[model samples]
Target chain A: MSDAALRSPLHAEHVALGATLVPFAGWEMPVRYTGDIAEHTAVRTAAGLFDLSHMGEISVRGDGAAAFLDHALVGRMSAVGLWGAKYTMMCTPEGGVIDDLIVYRRDWDHFIIVANAANKDTVIAELGARLAGFDAALEDVSAEIALIAVQGPRAEEIVARMCVRGDDDIHAMRYYTAANILLTGDIHAFAARTGYTGEDGFELFVAADQAAAVWELALAEGAGDGLVPCGLSARDSLRLEAGMPLYGQELTRDTTPFDAGLGRIVAFGTAANPRGAFVGRDALLRAKAAGPARVLVGLVGDGRRAARTGYAVTDDAGTQVGTVTSGAPSPTLGRPIAMAYVPPALSAPGTVVGIDVRGRREDMTVVALPFYSRAS
Target chain B: MATVPEELAYSAEHEWVSGDTDAGVVVTVGITEHAAEALGDIVYVEAPRVGDTVVAGEVCGELESTKAVSELYSPVSGVVTAVNEALERAPEAINADAYGDGWIFKVELSESATDLLDAEAYAASVA
Candidate 1:
């Protein structure tokens, strides 16, 4: 890590835990505490706490908040229920993705949008330019806030114990719903049943100064349940196993949601009930109608060698078909898995393909989207 | 704080060579504990062919970890005598016991190389 790199609020805690720090998106963040595989297994079996403070948080408020967001994002913001969170994306007019974000509706006219750390400035600038005459106010609250997550099978029991509020119960909180929680010593925080890992979890949004306190408190409360402090490396592998698309990897400015096999995220207008009034509506509709030329697919390799990002995906004839976006040896599955973008004709399950790993065309079979999912 | 065996000859690329430097020299090669720790979990080890010849400081194979792939470089010029076939099914043995059971291969030296560093020198170089 460089001297001038941005540090997380829990930087001290990570250093105390002997974490290996690395530079990610201009921020010096913990990549692992003990090791990547160990932390990943902890999340899958027990629980793991993650410091996601580097993510961006932007607030939108005013009477036109919902309307403004409807025009700003691809998902229908007007349909977001109170205290409901929705996964959506901001796109260019040409249907190219700008960033995928999650919006939490605090009230009818107030909402908070959490975005990726690397694209924080891009999202702020693009939204600022598009809010010329909008009645909503956009405030970047990234620096003032910190995001922490407790994820696993024991997540609910652990996070439910952290909320000191007698009136609010975390057990009653539905998935993707947010609530205000009062912790010990009157530390107020916003808790949501949301996480990147494909497990039951809760994300706590707290003040920057109170982040370390909350982190220690959560870890202590969940210690007996096997909650370990994880880092970005484990988080990446866990999300990849869940079949989630990363911002710069699976998504980019040149690709539309349809190209990533996420066309359902886009709200195209219908004659009977028109709701497509946002950017990229036309281009996305055209892409949807014509069907995406290429689609994202999951690939399972025959051996232990993982096909990492930027590896070339070739057909049986050895012709270049697409490129790998993300991949790793799944700690749970005991096999190498990856996600790549290939033509729709070759995206179906059982399609034979080859991944060019280290100049060798390793055999890979196209599988389903998610390689692992916790039983509900 | 990785374990660095004092009796081993170390290469700048983090491989440790162990054997008697006799008239007809043969040495067993494996990645150091420090290198294994830095590489995260070892998932695969690509070994050189038994009859293949490798030169010092040349890439002969690769070690695939959970995080990324690292090149395996030869510490001295030699012809491969044997490869660790056990690693094909259980690569995690490198993470658990990188020095003993995780030995990657053995090479019969054509001309003994004298540029390899001792344990202390290798530790200092890494530090």
Candidate 2:
């Protein structure tokens, strides 16, 4: 696609910082601003700002919003109160995941769902079909919303400084919760205390026209704490280190929540659960009982030779067991780590496996999830 | 952008060849600054082990960034005399200083060094 057809609010800022621009999810995104390691280190050590406007935002509103969402999504949306957000999945009838999303409960009658950019249309279509008989309205508001993530240890302080109104209250917002904030002058932003980087942070949702101003304000406020404008490259590495799943990588249409090891989010029986039925519930319940054939697990290489996506995962005897979904030479861990699906027998921690890197089988070991975790 | 050192020979693949070319023709090879710029960031460098044999245009190492993985091809046939042990600890040196401290491997070239490009030729090739 042409450069004009794909743009972000931070396009000029990225160019000013000499970022390597690349197209992702139909938007021109910065792959790396200054350097990947530098940006990655900034997020791990201090703080980092990310322009995440490419993520899709869909609004579900009206009387039956709660019931409609509970019926259409896998997570218990009825349990989420105002200002609460729950990570959930929309699935196909065959138990395959349509898209993993975050459902934010604005109120009893209004909800906002954030989905992967590439799966926006599919998710909207599925939700629309499921809400046919319900008294609800679904609208795709992706183009009008701009999302920015400020993540790391110093996130709260940095964000507070940017917003001149009652900055102290920002720290009281619990993780996975959100609130509307009145920033300096007349700028109003919806800030959610949620992030994929496994860091203490907030994701700000603002009008598309206000994105550049808010981005500049945050950067200026965070300058002292070594906050950098991180791009997609650092964002991927940070999320990988946190063991969070990506859409095309850890999630796909053929992959169920059970296979992805997300059963905890699937609420089978609850008061707020839909009455009649939902798609994929039966198949998912069956998989939950019998256990999935393959399970997603973390893999750590012996050295810096990363096991990239599509690399064959094998047992010690070189038997092909599975394939790597997402892999990278971790900037934080200083080694190659990957997420892959392996046979249930070989999913245990410390189980030795091999990753075929460029036709050569490199030794690896199955490890526990979340290669890196923030201090609570 | 960092300038390509005039004293070093370069390859079409953006690897720089430096070091002594007189006594036994020992040359150290690393990626150019321009290549590092394109790579965005350097996360890992899988350098060939000491004493390994490599052929020209063959991949002797691998370089991985957050976004992609690329093969570090050998610019000249040689026996790997030494690998950058520091890269195992801090691979970002390839991004910070692609020409100096980020030198990947040292090799004893098997043939004369006349096949490599000069600084101007390498720049022109990339352009």
Task: Identify the leading candidate in terms of lDDT.
Answer: 1
DockQ of each: 0.72, 0.66
Candidate with best DockQ:
1
Q: What lDDT does candidate 2 reach at residue A349? A: 99
Question: Per-residue CA lDDT of candidate 1, range A1-376, in tens?
Answer: 4888899899999999999888999899998898888899999999999999999999999999888889989999889899899999999999999999999998899999999999999999999988877899999999999999999999988887877782256888999988888976578889989999998899999999999999999899999999999989899999999999999999999899999888888877578868847888889889889998888999999877899999999987888889999998888888899999998888889998999998888888999989889999
Q: Which regions of candidate 2 are displaced past 4 Å?
A: A166-168, A270-275, B1-9, B18-26, B49-51, B80-90, B112-127
Candidate 1 residue runs with Cα over 4 Å from true position: A166-168, B19-23
Docking class of 2: medium
* Worst window of 10 by summed lDDT in candidate 2 chain A: A270-279
Candidate 1 C-alpha lDDT tens digits along B1-127: 7888899999999999997643359999999998998898888889899999998899999998778889999987889999999999888888889899999999999887788889899999877
- Estimate how well candidate 1 is docked, as a DockQ score: 0.72
- Looking at candidate 1 chain A, the ten consecutive residues that score lowest on lDDT are A160-169
Q: List the residue pairs that clash in candidate 2.
A: none
